[model samples]
Structures are given as structure tokens and as C-alpha cells.
Target: MRVLGVDPGLTRCGIGVVDGAPGKPLRMAGVGVVRTPADADIGERLVLIERGIEAWLDEHRPQFVAVERVFSQHNVRTVMGTAQASAVALLCASRRGLPVALHTPSEVKAAVTGSGRAEKAQVGAMVTRLLRLDAPPKPADAADALALAICHIWRGTASDRLRQAVAAQRLRTPKGTA
Candidate 1:
């Protein structure tokens, strides 16, 4: 499966593409960041993010989009920007009729590094080793994006299959059955 992972932020949104299956080796198809000027108006920054995400969707043509779920933070301003950026990503994927999965930071960290509370550097190191990269992707955000993709590939595929199986079973079962 080909998946595009998005790490949304107002200043620098991370984008990464990965190709892999649940029990197969992974490959990095692409990785980059979308930068918006901090001084720019919020609306303008969102537009820039939309454009950037659209370009990535065009280039990667991923089957699924994995985005970092926005979580609460002490800094309300920071969380607001993250939520806004995340919405842009969700919009872009939905427009393309792509399956979207939102993975929390803890889930991503645990999937990649065996610890939900793993440090950023540890996550980067694990991502590097998992992808067989010569070095960790820069700016932390880039690495985080790749980690999101890896997490989805490892976890989302199984979840999808389980969901499908349950739906199929329900269809096969008689009506009014428990």
C-alpha cells in the first residue's frame, strides 16, 4: 500500500510518502515540509498548506492518507494552528476519495519505538533504522511524518481487514440475530 503521512503545523507541515504492506519491507517514496511564514495571516497560511498538500496528493497518488491527530496542549494557540492544519489535510484526502486515518502521537511513537512516551530523537532513530535511511529526516517534523506513515502501514492495514471481516460477517448473519 502507498500511504501519505501528514504532520500538520502552521509554520512547517511535514509530508511523507511510503510504500509497504503489513508484513513487508517499507520504502520511502518521498518526504518534505510545507513552510508558511509565521507572520502571514492565518487564512493565508491555511491556503498555502492546502496548496502544498494538493501538490503532494498529485505527486504521490497515495491509496491512504495518515494524519497526526490533533491533541490538546497547554498552548492553546499552538493547538489551534495544528487543528487547522490537520483539517486541511483531511479535506484534501476526502476530496480525492482516499481513506484517511488519524494516528495519535502516542500511537505513532509506540508503533515505531516500542514506547508511547519515546523521545523525539528515539523516534527519529527508529524511523531511520526501519526505513534503512542513511540519516534521520531533518527538522523533526519530517521524521515525525515518516513515522506516521510507518505506523499506519503497520497498524491500519490490520484494522481495515478486521473491520471488513466484521462487516462481512454481519451481512452473512440472519436479521434479528444477536
Candidate 2:
């Protein structure tokens, strides 16, 4: 499966594309950051984010999009920008009719580094090793994006299969059955 992982932020939204399946070797199709000037108006920054994400969608054509779920933070301004950028990613994927998954930062860390509280450096190192890259992707955000993709490829595929199985089983059961 091909996945585009988005680590959304107003100043530097990270974007990465990875191709893989559970128990299979992974490949890094692409990785980069979408930067918008910090001084730009909120609406303009969102527009830039939208365009950047759209371009990635056009180029990578991922089957799924995995985005970092926005969580509460002490800095309201930072959180607000993150949430806005995240919305852009969600919008872009939905417009393309692609499946989108939101994974928490801890979930991504756990998937990549075997610890929910793993440090950014650890996650970056693990991402590099997992993808067989010569070095960790820069700016922490970039590695985080790749980690999100890896996590989804490892976990989302199984979750999807389980959901399908449950639906299929329900269809097979009688309507009046519990």
C-alpha cells in the first residue's frame, strides 16, 4: 500500500510518502516539508498548506493518507495552527476519495520505536533503519511524517481487514439475530 503521512504545522508541515505492507520491506517514495511564512495571515497560511498538500496528493497518488491527530497543547496558538493545517490535509484527501487515518503522536512513536514515549531522535533513527535510508530525515517533523506512514501501514491494514470481517459476518447473520 502507498500512504502519504502528514505532520501538519503552520510553519513547516511535514509530508512523506511510503510504500509497504505488514511484514514487508518498506520504501520511501518521497519526503519533504511544506513551509509557510510564520508572518503570513492565518487564511493565507492555510491556503498555502492546502496547495502544498494538493501537490503531494497529485504526485504521490497515495491509496491512504495518515495524518497526525491534533492534541491539546499548552500553547493555544500553536495548537490552532496545527489543527488548521491538519484540516487542510484531511480536506485534500477527502476530495480525492482516499481513505484517511489519524494517528496520535504517541501511537506513531510506539509503532516505530516500541515505546509510546520515545524521543524524536529515537523515532528518527528507527525510521531511518526501517526505510534503509542513509540518514534520518531532517527537521524532526519530516521523520515524524514518515513514522506516521509506517505506523499506518503496519496497523491500519490490519484494522481495515478486521472491520471488513465484522461487516461481512454481520451480513451473513440473520436480521433478527443478536
Candidate 3:
């Protein structure tokens, strides 16, 4: 299945698309960022975000979307913009009746780099390796977004994977086993 991962920011939103299948590597469909003017009002920026997400959804047709959950950075202004950007991403996914799951930053980092506290550069490095690309994914923000997507592809609950795990366990156990 195709999953779209999003990292929402006030000035730039990161987006990554990956296909998830058990025992198979993540297929990097695309990676990018949606940039908004720093001086623009929040409302207009939100509109741009919404349009960008919608465009990605229409183009990629991902089965699901995973977005980074909001966390306050202490600065009220920054927090507000992150929230708005996040809302636009969620709204875009909801509009298509797609199930959207949220993952925390630490969770994304751990999934990508074996450490929850991995730096942005580390995450970018692992993302580059995971995708088998020689050059790092362009633009730090976009690269981070792609890493977030890769995290979800690795750790997100996939129905088929779950079903297969259950089936395997059942076969290994005796009848009526607990």
C-alpha cells in the first residue's frame, strides 16, 4: 500500500510518499516540501497547505496518510502555525475518506534511526541509505519529511502484515492453545 507521510511546519511542510509491503523495502514514490511565504498571513498559508496536500493526494493516491502529531515548541507563534499546517494536512486526508494515523516525532526518529533522539542530519542520513540514494534528499525540511514517511512505512501497522503474523503464530501452536 502507498502511504503519504507529512511533516508540517509554518514556513515549509515536508511530504514523502512510500509504498509499504511486508518483507519488501519502501518504494520512494516521491519526496518534497510545500513552502509558504514567511510574511503571509496564517489563513492564506493554510490555503496553500491545503492545496498542496490535495494536489499530492490526487497525484499519488496513497492508501493512507501518516502525519506528525503536534508538539508545542514553547514559542506560541510557532506552535500556532504548526497546528494550522497540521490541520490542513489532516483535512486533506479526511476529505478523501482515507484513514490518517499520527506518529510522534520520537517514534518517527526511532523507527528511522534506531534512536529516538536522532538529530535531523542523522535522520536525513538514514533516509538516504534506506532509499538507496547516493545524494541526500534535497532541502533539510523535505528530507526530514521523507524520513518521517520512511519511519511510518517501517513501523506503521499494516493489515496484511498483522494477518500474516497471526496466521503464523496460530500454525505454530497446538489446537485451542492460549
Off by over 4 Å in 1: 161-178
lDDT of 2: 0.91
**What's the number of clashes in each of the models?**
0, 0, 0
What ranking emerges by lDDT with the best candidate at the front?
Answer: 1, 2, 3
Candidate 2 colliding pairs: none
TM-score of 3: 0.85
List, residue by residue over 84-111, the lDDT tens digit for candidate 2. Answer: 8999998887655577889999999999
lDDT for each residue of candidate 3 in 1-178, tens digit (9 for 90 to 100) = 7888899987889998888665688678988999999889878988888889899999999877889888886689888888889998987876555667788989988988899999988988898888887888878877777777777667776563554355446555554532
- Clash pairs of candidate 3? none
lDDT of each: 0.91, 0.91, 0.81
RMSD of 1: 6.6
Q: Please provide TM-scores, in order, for all candidate models, with all chains considered together.
A: 0.89, 0.89, 0.85
Q: Candidate 3: worst 10 consecutive residues by lDDT? A: 159-168
